[model samples]
Target: MRIYLYILAGLSSALIGWNIGQFFLTDIGLFKEFPEVTLFPCIAISLACGMVMNEIFISNPTRPKLSWRIAKTPLLIAVGLGTLAGLISGGISQILFLPQIRFPTPIVRIIGWLLIGASVGLAEGLTWRWHSMEAGDPKRFWQRFKVSVLGASTASLFAAAIFELIRTTLGAMPAEFKGVEDPLGFSILGLLLGLTFSITNSPSYLGALRAGTGFEYTGENYEDIDPNLQPVNKSSPCIDKSILKFVNNGDAYEIEEGLSIQLPGTGTVRIGSAVKKANIYIPGLPLHVADLELKNRDAILKPNRVAFNCIEVNGERLTSGDDIRRLKHNYVLTFYSEKKDGIKEPKIYRFVYYNRFLDPQA
Candidate 1:
């Protein structure tokens, strides 16, 4: 049953994590008599139990080799990322945390980094990747990061709770002290490091969907699969989505002030240079946008420095405004304060009723 596979995955990850951590803990002399305790034997038994559970209830009859390879990528990525972080953190410790205390030399620091990275890669990666594969596409970098945060937080809380329970049961919790190592206390240092990993280097929800839909990595980036799911472009507002609606019989049209002006309710704005040399200005509108249709369908705002004699609605000028009441229909704006010619060119400014903040479903 899939439930058994899930159980086996969790138990295997946790036991393996604990076992690998035990060797490091023992090395640091934190648990001096760890060998004498039944913990090692208990761990071995748990591993056996997981293996049997998988073999009996969750064995795959088809494409075992391919499945194994697919599963291995997460493990590899985890190791690579973990090792990188440990070294960086250890090196920074010398500069940041070590000045307050005596510290290790360069070679010793390198060794420490390797140990930390390896432990974290093995422990956190196994658990998170195995359990969270359903949440999104592993290739979706942001989705991965979000799921990683959730998974790491869960694991940390579980590990910390278990550690605290043991401490309470044995009455061996370390006393509060300044800069003193408690020989008997145990900390899931990997969990702390994993939190950072999840935040910085995770995949996305689409990754889970990709994995679910039988998507293969093929040695390519995960995002390569979903061309339709690409993130919205952020560099220019021109590519940004616009909201324009037709109001009654009115239409959208463009004005010739180096900006595209849509007719009231008319969706099309005439894209061209203004006929008059006079500049145009709109006031009292926040987040104002002066959309200009450049050649080749590119829409943009007017250059502010070239049209500097204007105030903003809400930090930005109104190329679009929420209240269509006064702005709706067709209104002409007159430019040029200097009265040279008796004839004045009117720039048409049309307002369309659009809720820029409207919910799509609503």
Candidate 2:
């Protein structure tokens, strides 16, 4: 469902942008004075494409709703990069297709559209954050750049080639719809660029975290169920049985159910009670209970000082000072909290980790 929304957003934004550009170029007489004036429409299309792509990237179900204030910085960066790309590609295309240059008309159109698609892809790639990379990871930028640019460009080239074939083989349309080709072509390019990027960046499921037998209540007894937690198969076999719930207690939101968090193949994810800070937020736990690091398909659980005496993995208490334990399939992490009566209850919350990639059942 979400993927379909993304594709729709991409296609619509591109079509609208292209129409806006066309209006300015033909209707407003901007292109009649100078051929180089085509850059304006390119800029419009690129800016719209950039904004939509960035919005899709930053969206998260567990996070707060996005507002203009929260999304401005990244959106601005995307716009700037996208505009620059548009300028370079548009300028180059114009120069290459000049009458004096004698370039083949079909070849020129194909190259121009390909460049436009690549520029949008490049901007999106540059703004993307690689979740698997930690600070100072040297390969991060290069990896993102390579994947985004190549994927987008290839998709765009394919779209342009198809559009060219349709235009040449089908001949011109009716006089009333004579100028519809550019907008239609741009829309196709946008759809393909977005589709290719999303397919390439789809998450590879390492496994999931399920509520263990010892797990307690997820929310207050009187609280209504969260709509986002509605039981539905997310299509991933590992997380088919898992459900997520968000509990708001005025100050912050908490994860009531053991949600399946995508553990990056490499990098550390903090597990704690801090809203918006912890990768996996468990209510009533310390702000920083532990760090779960993935290395070579192994999950390393390191308990922090505040949670040393409270955390137990597979029924063994975690001690203070850098004690790290490896997690296995069906291993339960039990968290304890003292009740108002001063009794320390065991198994306040239990998270069972399962790695389907290596499991025989998978």
Predicted structure with the largest TM-score when compared to the true one: 2
RMSD of each: 18.5, 13.6
lDDT of 1 by residue, 78-191 (tens): 544444543354345444434566554433333333343334434443434343322222443354445444554454344445444554555554456321221221224333
- TM-score, one value per model: 0.28, 0.56
Q: How many backbone clashes does every candidate have?
A: 30, 0
**Worst 10 contiguous positions by lDDT, candidate 2:** 233-242
Question: lDDT by residue for model 2 over 1-362, one digit each (tens)?
Answer: 65575567667767766666667677887765444346533543554454344444434433434334344554666666566656666676677677899878777667666666666666665544422221022464566568777887798788888888777755756655646777677777777766776665453335445554433443342225662343232111121112221111221223335333334566777766665466665556676788887786688888887678878888888777477888887788877653445556643767777653221111
Off by over 4 Å in 1: 20-61, 84-141, 172-362
Model 2 C-alpha lDDT versus the unseen true structure:
0.58
Minimum summed lDDT over a 10-residue window in model 1 is located at 205-214
Q: Which stretches in model 2 have alpha-carbon errors above 4 Å?
A: 33-58, 61-67, 130-141, 172-177, 204-349, 352-362
